[model samples]
Target: MPEPANALQRLHVHLNETRLLGSISSALYYDQNTVMPAAGAEWRGEQLALLASQIHARQSSARYAELVGEAEAELEAETKAELGPSVPTERRRNLQLVRLELERQRCLDPALVASLARAQSKGNALWQTARRHNDFPTFAPALAELIALRREQAGQLAAAEAVPRSPWEVLAQPFEPDISKTRLEELFSPLKATLPGLLEQVAAAPAQQGGLNEAAAELPEAEQESLCSELLNSWGYDPARCQRSRSAHPFSCTLGPQDFRITTRVVPGQPFSSFLATAHEWGHSLYEQGLPRSTDHYFPWPLGEATSMGVHESQSLFWECRVARGRAFAARWQPRFVAGAGGDPWGGVDGFWRALNPMRPGPTRVEADELSYGLHIVLRFELELALLEGGLPVADLPGEWNRRMVELLGLRPASDSEGCLQDIHWAEGLFGYFPSYALGHLISAQLAAAMQRQIGPIETHVAAGQERVVQQWLAAHVWPLGRAVNGEELVEQVTGERLSAAPFLSYLEAKVQQLLASAHH
Candidate 1:
């Protein structure tokens, strides 16, 4: 064991070094999604495999474990001596978080980690091809391999953790700490029961006249990209620290402490799609920017990391649904839409809002209407859970996906590309991640309700074209919290209750009523 005096220093060096390794891996992933050529896939797989092995070895090393233990023990002595505050709360947070992560990481087989990394890189490449060719068979083998590895990972973690958990539960903990499968089912069952009825109601509504709204204008892809940039700027995205680019799918990633990059695709004939993607991705960036940072060290220490993907997704959904899709926002930005869109295809703010808050469902999860978005997540979550449990075979995924879509959303995908292969989650071995998208919607609505209670209506600020007010409010309440709180804890802290679907269901009901009344008007 190292000396106590130097253990802290050694630990800091190790943590920073590991952080750099992870940053390099993140950059590689970002490039793989955005700019890496197709022919580079095999080498990229090898590169990521090497990095994953190195990262796993470093994180799970006995020496690093000793350093963390010694560092914690030293901090404990300070707490007994009434010097805890002097040590800084963030330091304690970092210690607590890193200890948990190391414990978890140490449970995994390093070779398994490397294998999963390589498989994911290869799977992503195959998935793109499969999606393009509408061929599920091309991707199923790699996806099956990834799923098998994830199940193995979950089993390893379950055996190592204090209380044993199921395979899916263990996998879910990384994305949503301490969230039980039972708890998720409890929260999700109501939405599952109600959403179908809601969909039925919307579908039966003669006023809605569902499906894609007529094009108000056909903005060129270049024009859409320009508008997306302007939109991100207006949302207070700091261009100095962020880069906007194109990708096969829209995503946001933090590559460094100061460098956050997000991607959005411009779709021809879809005037506001790119802008909405920008706002969604910008919301993600804002959360990253506002995370707790240590003045002492600058490697995105565990304490400063976003609490969970659920919490992170809530920030994005808040901007996408609660703010950007609201009436006031539509009114304030209607002119921008009309000007950029090249005509009043949407007629007015009401029209634009209707266009966004479409009642009909879609095959693509990313482009699904706000009302049906949770259903999309529900379909994926159930399938992933079943897949992990070996209840759903990979070969049968496309059939199950289409079946669930028709059952939940009143439509079936015409092909595998629009169905099972639509999302990048399964391809990346992210089995437990789908739930976070729906969790985010629930958290966003609950937080919005709480925000209304404290800071007044969100509409007033957004209508006044003062989105910074909302951003600052989030910065104060949730953004800087990082991993200091878990998903349920954060929801309870902000909303005076644990996770619930009530707020979200209520918000949807209100939206439907508003839309119906407008149609009548």
Candidate 2:
């Protein structure tokens, strides 16, 4: 056996190489989404497939297993030594991630990995085309294929674990990890039962909409981009170290420890949409930037990665929903926002605020109002769960989505573009990722409540344009920990409570009630 120090060195080298590959792949994906021309989709798909196969092969190889084993043995020995129990917990956590990933990949056949990768690559183009035409049929074949591939992938993973639960649960493992179907039902069931009534009450309440109101103004694209850059810079983003671009959907990706990229989309009628999306994506970038910089744990491993998508979503939602949407933030920045868009500052603030917090139901999840956002996710969760468990057929998705939208939101999408084809998740075979959005909202609310307790009124700070205070608070309590703690432990550590929907529901209810009350008088 290699010496403990030698084993640790080898494992570190291996992990770093994996991180580099993963980062490079992510950079490619970001570029593909933002700047890659439509003509290059075929080549990009091939490139992504090759990279995916390489990463899977490397991760599943015996050499990687040996390195992990050596590190694990050394850590075990060190824990029993005179060095006390203070040894870095990240080391053990890194090994656990490696083992879990290895097990997951081992369950998936290499051929299936390649096929899934290729399908996803091609599906992206199909989705783009379908979305452009607002026609689901154009994208249906590719989406069906993607779903079939994901179902197979789920089965393989489940069979490898020797557990035969629902396929959605298997698919969800990558995103939520230990979350079970029963637990999801517990968290969602009450909201599902209670939200409709609450939404009705909100709709019926005398509207109190007097926040940031602005007339829809045409801001040039270049001007909007410049404003986005300025906003990011003010938020401490270094252009030399990070990049932002436009895409159909907004997302953030990290290429390395220092290199991060985020994309935003421009809505013609709503300029704040792009600005707020930029803030949200920056939140994700900041979390990536906050990972522990210790020699032992860095990137692409459990120690350096985020706890879960839910936690990641929490960070983004924290900045976007909690900080950006706060009345204080608007009060302070209303001038700049109006000046940039070349509109009346006073009129723009109130209109923009109301537009930002509009309570109306919408068809697209990303574009949905905060109040109705979870319902969008809930719809997907139900459909995806059914698709994976064989309770719903791919052919029936369009009708099913329309039916549920009406039932939940009392509105129906006029077309599939606003309905089934709105999101890229299913087309890209992302079956189990939807729930994290809702979970992120829940986590954000809980964390915000805790922040309020510690900082004494975060909304006041936000309104005063003291965003740095909130950012610094998160950097200390939430961001620096990275994957050092699991989801449940992280929630408990920061909030002193188990994860619950009460904080989120309370937050939502309070905001809606206040908005409704103001609209009346």
Candidate 3:
């Protein structure tokens, strides 16, 4: 009856409406992180909690589940006579994805959902204060609460699943399905074994800094902002379509389809840090800009969204590390750097390249060089496993974090702010997110290798500022497809290589040699 409810059409309308709701929610989140006055956090928290509750209820509602089920039934029932010779492939995929999401939402507890929102809201504020004060105790309680809430959420997911799983594994599924601790250990083992020695060799090399970065410390915030804007335009981001500004931590979010916003923070006296952050966040904005969307709508349905956080991070890292930190790219932009700072601070592109790609370890992960970035992730991943599964007490995290930093990077953080509290992930209850950044580097290298094999040398295009050639290749092979497949499938489909860290490691080893040679000369 009722012509089987026009499942695809109804589902599209409902999903679009859901996307609209999500856009509004994202706007509030953007403002909270960007423009929201610090005093207004309480009101903002309430707004976020209410939105979270409403969205969860709507998504997990009986009628919504029924509609999804009916849509699935229709997919199975419809024949050539009713439909046509060809299947509605896209619609079928969308419905299938939506159905899976609906089932997941159904498993979530509304009360827990609201509590998690509240935890994030409060946790962020406390983290800001704690970081500013360099007081781990101040943020520890909130962190502990957020961790508990995440654990509870993971338990709920595990309860609904057919197979038994660890809490970390269950938590990871939301970011990357089929991700497991066992799998991650196997993948990270090589990097853990190799990076320390590499760091020692590179750091010990002559001309590590080459005195190119001295002028960078004197660059002001205003000048950096202008340079960032120039960099944005150079990357082909439309000013009207996308916006950039300052934030506590650099990030990118979409407030509307055409409204892409990215935030980069300027560290006074560390001139190039913000530039790199801008590049990193811009990569995120570009991915958002390139995702498949409804021509009339800004928010994409599930199939149009990023497949996984790892893939999203890959896109960002590709631009930030693969392109921006490349020797050719540094050569092309040397004139601009001199112009921006009013002098040739780096002396030449060779010195400029060394400054941008540090081989030494650092306290901050976001500011880490390509060679050391994966080690940062490895440290975080090991810490998370301990916190979530190894029974490590939250109160002892600062010490544990410091110990690991010394062990992994041979540099201990001066304070908890630069150590355990550096990232916003734990503040927002994002335990499974760190691994993605390392995974991203791997995917970017693998994908870059594939792109090179298919096209020409990547450096050739990037050096000439012909980024569109690289962008177009990714657009054709990666962004448009979105989450149609999982991360492994996406990598294999594009690169003809199964997911592995070897490509990323190989790429880095070559980069180290290049940096060393540049240093020597």
Among all candidates shown, the one with the greatest lDDT: 1
> What residue pairs are clashing in model 1?
216-345
**lDDT tens per residue, model 2, 197-273:** 77777667534444433454556777778878878888899878898888988999888777888999988767677
2 against 3, candidate with superior lDDT: 3
Q: Which ten residues in a row have the lowest lDDT in candidate 1?
A: 208-217
Give model 2 RMSD, 1 decimal.
Answer: 2.5
lDDT of 1 by residue, 1-521 (tens): 65335656778878888989998999999999999999999999999999999999999999889889988888889889998669877778788888888988999999899999999999999999999899999999999899889888887787666777888988988899887778888888888888877777877776754322565467777777777777787887787899988888899999888999999987665666788888889889999999877575345477678889999999999998888778888787778767765777776667667777777788888777777898998888888777988578889888888888888888999999888988888889987888999999999999999999988999998888788888888999997778878988998988888789999999998888887666656
RMSD values for the candidates in order, in angstroms, are 2.1, 2.5, 2.2
Per-residue lDDT tens digits for candidate 3, residues 63-127, read 78877777777777775357744665666777777777777788899999999988899999888
State the weakest 10-residue window (summed lDDT) of model 2: 205-214
TM-score of each: 0.96, 0.94, 0.96
lDDT of all predictions:
0.84, 0.80, 0.83
Ranking by lDDT: 1, 3, 2
Q: Number of clashes in every candidate structure? A: 1, 17, 0
